[model samples]
Every structure is written in structure tokens, then in C-alpha cells.
Target: MVMWWLSSQPKGQRQVVVSILPSFICWHIWKARNKAVWEGISLSSGDICHGIIQDVVLAVSSEVNRWNLLPFFDQFFDRLSEPPMPLQCKIVRWRAAGTRIATLNTDGCSKGNPRASGGGGVLRDSEGRFLIGYSVCLGVSTSLLAEVLALLAGLRFCHQRGFTQVRVQSDSLVLVGILQCWFQCSWQIRREVFHIWQLAEDSGHFSHCFRETNTVADILANEGLLHPLVQMKIYNHPCMLPQLARGALRLDRSGFPSLQLLKRTPA
Candidate 1:
């Protein structure tokens, strides 16, 4: 029934709904099923539908523009149509590390949680010169897993290259907090993060930066999705060089993504 409703929307809106709605809806259904089986709890049809609608609205709000989604939002809330919220602008240009410490920026991408995903990282010297970088395709995984994977890849690369002094930067504040001893993580996260902290702990620092400041690494993550690596295959991946060259990946005069440069590219 929801699938039929999705098909009735304009192509642009339909695509957005298709990409986000199915997994979100299915996941909730699955969770509800699990509760029914394990905990003997049941939710009414109305309750489930309302929950799904809320989830869809929040998830799409981030990626879709406000004006483009006004009608869709109206459909959900009906007679009490909520005003579209203004977009928030918080990201700043990527900054360099101090002195001789190299800064590594990392990010993750996923089509869906437990779906096609990948991780990427960019290494730069304190002088802000781009050095080696990496992007790996993980066939399936949650985004948090992908986030940890990207951090692991970057930290391992630095360790192998004998980078004695380094600093790690990420847009995910949760990941940063875990590294900074602020919060405990899942056992899986605990294990992977231990290795990274060891690698960078001696002469390193972990910090949280806005996503706008992590542009180089963000492109690297998108590159991973665009061209997933296969085992035994040596890809002459540009490290997303083509995007950087064509202004598709976009960087400022200092070769970092800036607020002024973060326009939404049309599909």
C-alpha cells in the first residue's frame, strides 16, 4: 500500500522516498515483530504508522531541501501543516594541525543501514598539503560500523607509514567522544577503537570537527561508494581527483570545503 503511494509522487520525490522509506519502514516492522515474539508486546496499526511517518520525516529532513519537501510534509501532518525549518549552517573550512603533527580526516557513507556502505580518509601534513589517502567499499554494514572502519583504515595506514605524530579529526562527534574517554561504546567498537587510540595515543590527539570541515574526507567516502574496491584489483582511483578537479568535490582557495562552497548539486 505504501509502495503504491510512493509511486504516485513526482519522480524527484519518489526517488527520495524509495531510497529512505523502505529500509526505515521495514526495520521498524522487523523490530515490532521481534517484540511480539520475544517480549509479547503488540502495537496498534495506527501507532506503527505514526512512528513510521515520524522516522521518515526526520530522516529525509537532513538530505532533502525544505521547499522541495513542503508538499510531502503536508501530506503527513495534514490540516496542521508545520512550517518548514530553516537550514542550519555550521561547517567551516578544514583546518591544519599544529606543527609537525599530520591531521587525518575521516567519514563514512551508506545507502542504508546494513546496506551498501564504505569508508574513507584523507591525510594531510600540518602545512595542509594532501598526502596519501584511502577509500574502501564494505559490501554491507551499519553506518557506525562504517565510521569505525574508516577510522581504522586511516589509523592503520598512518601506523604502517610510520607517522609518529598525528591528529585525527572526524565529523562524527560520537566517534570522537569514544576516543576521548567521554563515553563507552559497544564491545565491537571498544575493540576497534582500542587499536586506534594505541596507534595515535602516544603523540596524537582526537578531535571533533563539523562535516563542512571534513570535505576532503567526505569526497573520499563518496568515491568509495562510486568505485568500490575489489580484492586483488589495483584501482587507479583518483582518490576522487576528478571530482576535485571538476569542482564537483569542491574545495575553497585553501583546498578545503567551506560554507560558501557547499551548494547542493542537482541530481
Candidate 2:
């Protein structure tokens, strides 16, 4: 109504009327809601919906009238009635020549100086099929150092397997940022991590994943402590290491890695 009124007046009157009208309506509604709430008056869902529709209609109508597009309101209403379909997410695969690329996920864990740590890597083809998994123990080290080592080992494994283009994934945000050149590492592990960065750069592509999305690598890392130096191979199936022996691997009171060798051999 304000916009229609402004359209009848001079062009200079449109902006002032449109701006003040919405502010006035918003203030009025806000004051009304507060008064009702303070007076112990409950608002129904219908009332809320009515208020929302009123606000939207007021804004849109004001803009349309100010622009003298009242005649197009019918077209806008028709379009709004049948909204466009949402876009679908499509997965794009990267292939070179005739071979598809590979994606690798790696993670590291330390239990106790060097800390008793383990690193894991999983290789998958472009079709998301598992190729192989690699996990190794780090005798002692910081978590960041373990992360760097894990990535380096993963990339090296991929390179050795003739993976020309590889996508690496990790749950370590710090390690991923450092590898992607998005964050700078402190002098503590800068020199040692440089080699890891170089390995990632040499690889085709890499990605950072949250821990939820990186459960495979996370499980492998923790399992590495149980089956240190043990490699299990499954034919035509995803391989998984058995659970860690109970009361075998213990963390020190200080929360460091403690090695208590169990009496079990890999079959």
C-alpha cells in the first residue's frame, strides 16, 4: 500500500516511504509479540505464520510498487507457487589416459618420546574400491609429527604402486592445512614436516576430511597398536585388523604410549 501510494507521488518520495514502512511494521510486530509474551499470552503457530507472510508480502509489495512493477506481481506470484527444483549433487571422477585416479586416506595416533604412535593409510581406486591399506607403528613422537609421517608413508606407497594421480585424505586439520599451504607450522616440526608437504605436492591432489568421514583411517591407526608390524590380506573384500588384545596395550598414567608385548603371532 505504501509503495502503491509512493508510485502515485513523486519519484523522490518512494525511497523514504518504503524504508520507513517496513521499519514501522517490524517495530510494531516486535512490540506486540513482547507485550503478549509479558501478559502471559501464548502465540499460536498460525499467528506466527500470518506474521511471517505479512512481513514478506509487505517487503515484496513495497519493492514492486516503488519500482512501478505492480503489473508483474501476478507473474511473481505464479513463479513463487511453483519453485524451481533443487540442484542435484553430481560426483566427478578424474581420469588420465585410460586409468582412473586413486584416493588415499591416512591418519596417525600416538599413545605415549618420541610417543608410541601408529600411522595408517588406505588406497582406493576411482570407483571407490579398496586397493590396499598400510599401517605402521612410530616408536615415539608428537601427534603432529605422526600425522606428517602418516601422509608421507601414504604418498610413498601410492607412488610405488604406480598411482600417478592420487587424492590423499586425512582427519588432522593441522596436518592438512600445512600440506595445503593454508597454515604455517611452527619451528617445532617445520623442518621435519617440510618433506611431508613435498610428498603431498608431488602427489596429484589431496583433501582434508573430518574425523567422522575418516573412520576407516582412524580405526586402522588405533588397530595398528594391536597388530604392530602385522599385515592382513583379504581376497576380494575389505580387510580389517582384529581388536587390540585386552590388558595388553596400556597407556602410562601420564597418558603416554607404553609397550607391553603380548604373546600372540599373526596367522
Candidate 3:
């Protein structure tokens, strides 16, 4: 139906290639809808667009032999494949449960496989105010290792500080699974993965969060790479404090949970 409507619009042949954007978007959305209804496969807009990009590329690859399609395809694919930026005014934020239980958000960053990396975590109280933040350089490793290290750092911080009740949140779904003992981990992450749950004890309840809500910690994780190879623990590092403050204020006003676990299944 979408293609039929587009065909009847008197678009030129050049427009034919560019027109794949809307047509593929609608096609993927429709495909996603049917999957949700019958196949029980859930897809986000990102997922749908990714599928569309792959399908469109495959479909257009055949046309390259007949037409000078490289330039158009390269530009279009680059624009489409770029990572989606987080919202500037995103309401999804860290919320405090009460004055007692601190909320922890952890994140990690890596340059490449077996490259320079860092892990960081932030602690906030019930009022959505920063309590503590820390960043540690991991020398060189994969991002997954850094992410696991971040969680370990957060959990260890809570335990060492004698914080009685805390909620731990991380954007790494795999890390959360390891914390829950969902499956066996590879040897590289196996040791620290066990260390996280052990350190959590009774005070910590780990949950998976979306990256949007975990922005502040992300800053610390990336910032670690720039800092001298030393761990720093403080509420507001001068360079990153302003951004964290703005993020906190937005979340506080929006009244989103300090740590919201994004659920996959329909509630």
C-alpha cells in the first residue's frame, strides 16, 4: 500500500532511490506490528530502522551494477547507521526512593577491543541529589569488562561505606543478568561478576536501566579516560558537575524514579 501510494505520486527515478527511506520505514513498522501480534517479537524504533537499513541496502546493492549508486547509498547509509543521540530534555532520570536508600548508577567506556577503558559510578540520595561519584581507569580492556568493573566499584563502594539499603542500576543488561546469576559468564568476567553479588550482600537490589537515564555516570566513565590514571571519589568534579546538575534537576522535576528498571515484556 505504501509503495503503491508512493509510485502514483509522480516522483522521478532519482527520487526512487531516496524514496526508500519512508517506504522502508513503513515496511519495517508494519513488519514489527505483525511480529508483535503473532510472532511475539518486540521491536523499538531503532530496531525497526536498523532492519529497514539492512533490507534497503540489500535491495539497492543489486541496482549498483546498472546505475552510479555508490555516492547516494554511502551517504544514506552513513546517516541512517549513525547512533541516535539521547534527548537533551529527556525526562527519564535518577530518582531517590527515600532519604535512606541511595541510588547507584554505573557505566563504562572503551576505546576498542583491548584498548584504553574506564568505569565509573554515581550515588544519589532520595532527593535526586548527588552524594558521591567515582571514576577509575582500567588501563586497557573491552567495554564489557569496564562495565562489569563499574558495577563492581559501585557495589564495593556501598559495602565499604556501610550503606545499609541501596538500589543499584546499570544500563548493561548483561551485567544485571550476571548479578542475578542468570547464566555462566566467560572466564575474563567470571571473577569480578561474582565479586559484585558478594559485595552487594543484603543492601543492594540490582536492576537494568536504559542508557538515557544513566547519563551522569556515562560522563564519569568517559571522563576517566582523560584524567590521570588515578581513581577519584567526589560529588562534583568541576568539569562534569554542571552537566550532572542539569541532568539531576530535569529528573527531579519530572519525578522519574531514581532507578527505573526497563521491562521488556508488556505489563
Candidate 4:
């Protein structure tokens, strides 16, 4: 019935308008309806019509093959143009946790940002002796997703082992910010982040660290890429890790700090 109705409509611009109209119209209508109900906004017919047409034109015009197809396209493109920002580098140092507290450092590895991902974490005492560690293959995933999953696994380990007042650290600043409620989490990893929250409750303190300081966990994350899918391998001692990872663990145990060059953002 809908196809027949669309067929009867006048074909505009190689039938592209007709092809995109049905879905776009329905979508805009649903959005308008929600705005009216939830926000208590008065939706005038003219306003709704204008919005739908503007959105459709923008959507179509932005397509690579359809660039500047509409009169307003040039205006939209001009507004979006911006100059690239400059970057400066700064040094950051990693410090060990205070005595009597456990530290959990986690890292995520991915071949591509959204492909062939894995997560790993290491738990250590205040003296930096390895208590437990884990590495799990996540198949294909985004870097953020892998990070969130690794944090989740680490938190679960702490909770199950009756470890309290733990300090959680990760190389991903975004992941730490999400835990600190400084930013919203991506929808893809919202569930895992939420689970981490539940697991941590009041006992976990989350913080961001440089990747250089998280060497062992980073190595484990790379190792995760070779593990079986969804399978988590546990390490009770650093000897269970690869040679490079074991060496890094020893450095960490010695309280040796790692330095990182980080982008210095403008105030």
C-alpha cells in the first residue's frame, strides 16, 4: 500500500525525493509527536512542515554524490567549515597507590578502533605485588567498549575476592571521566559501565593514568587478541605472563614511574 502510494507521487530529482520521503516523513512526525508530548511544545503545522523539509534537504545534500544538490547546501557547508586546532605536548607521570589499598590497572587493545578488540586488567596490592590478572578476547569492538569491559572484569574480580577500598585506573581518560560522571558514556558500553558502577558501589575509586604506566595490562590486552573468543584467562602470578609483561610487572613492583607525552589542551 505504501509503495503504491509512493509510486503515484510525482518523482522529484531522479525519484530520490520519493525514495527518501516515506521514512523521513514518518521519522520527523514521530519526533515532532514526542516533542509535543514530552516537552509540551505547541507544534504548528507550518513549523513541522518547515522542519521536515529542512532536515530532508540537509540529509540529502550532505551525501557525497548529492553535495550541493539543494540551494541551502552551500550555506550549510560554509557554516561547518573550521580551522584545525594546534596541539602541544606535556609530560605525565604514573604513581603507585598508597599503602593498604589495592590498585587495578586496565587497558584495551584493538587492531582497528572498531575491529579485533580485547581487554585486560591487573590487580595489585599497595606494594605492587600482583594479586590477580585477566585477559579476555572481545572479538570485534570499539576501543571504548573494550576499555569498559576490562574495567567491568577487574571490578568483578575485586568484589568477588573481598578486596575493599580499591583504586581503579585506566589509560583511557574518556572511560575514567565516564566513571567520574564527568561525561556521558557511549550507548554501546553503557550496560557494561553501569555494571561496573553496581560492582564498585562505594568501595572503588576510579582514576585516569598514562598508558606507559599501564604497561603490563596493555601487554595483556594485546595478548587477549590471541585468546579464544569470550574466554578470560586468569593469571595468579607474573610468571604466567609473557616475558615482556613479566619484566614490566617487575618495574611496576619496584615503584618505577613511567612518563607519557600528552596533548596540552588550551584553557
Candidate with best TM-score: 4
lDDT of each: 0.68, 0.58, 0.69, 0.75
Model with the higher lDDT, candidate 1 or 2: 1
Candidate scoring better on lDDT of 3 and 4? 4
- Over 1-267, each residue of candidate 3 has an lDDT whose tens digit, in order, gives 566436643344334556666777778889899999999989997777667756666675633333233334456644443333332332355555446778888899899867988878777777666666778777788988999987787777766777646888888888777777675687999888777767777423888877867877887888778765476555454345647645654565466555444423322
Query: Which wins on lDDT, candidate 2 or candidate 3?
Result: 3
| Residue pairs of candidate 3 with colliding backbone atoms | 94-258, 95-257, 95-258
- What is candidate 1's lDDT per residue for 156-193, written digit by digit as tens? 87777787677888998888777777877878677888
RMSD from true fold, candidate 1: 11.4
Name the weakest run of 10 consecutive residues (lDDT summed) in model 2. 245-254
Output the better candidate (3/4) by TM-score.
4
Estimate, for each residue in 1-267, the C-alpha lDDT of model 2 and write its tens digit. 655535543333243444455565566577568868798676665565455444545665533332232233244334334323443433322221124866777888888635678777667675555677767776678788878777777777767767746777777878777766778877887876676656656522556665544555666676656665554222123534333311111111112332333333323
C-alpha lDDT of residue 125 in model 4: 84
Displacement of the residue 74 alpha carbon in candidate 4, Å: 36
Error of 1 at 160 (Å): 1.7
Q: What residue runs in model 2 are displaced by over 4 Å at the alpha carbon? A: 1-99, 112-114, 202-204, 228-237, 240-267
Give the number of colliding residue pairs in candidate 2.
8
TM-score of each model, paired residue for residue: 0.59, 0.48, 0.58, 0.62
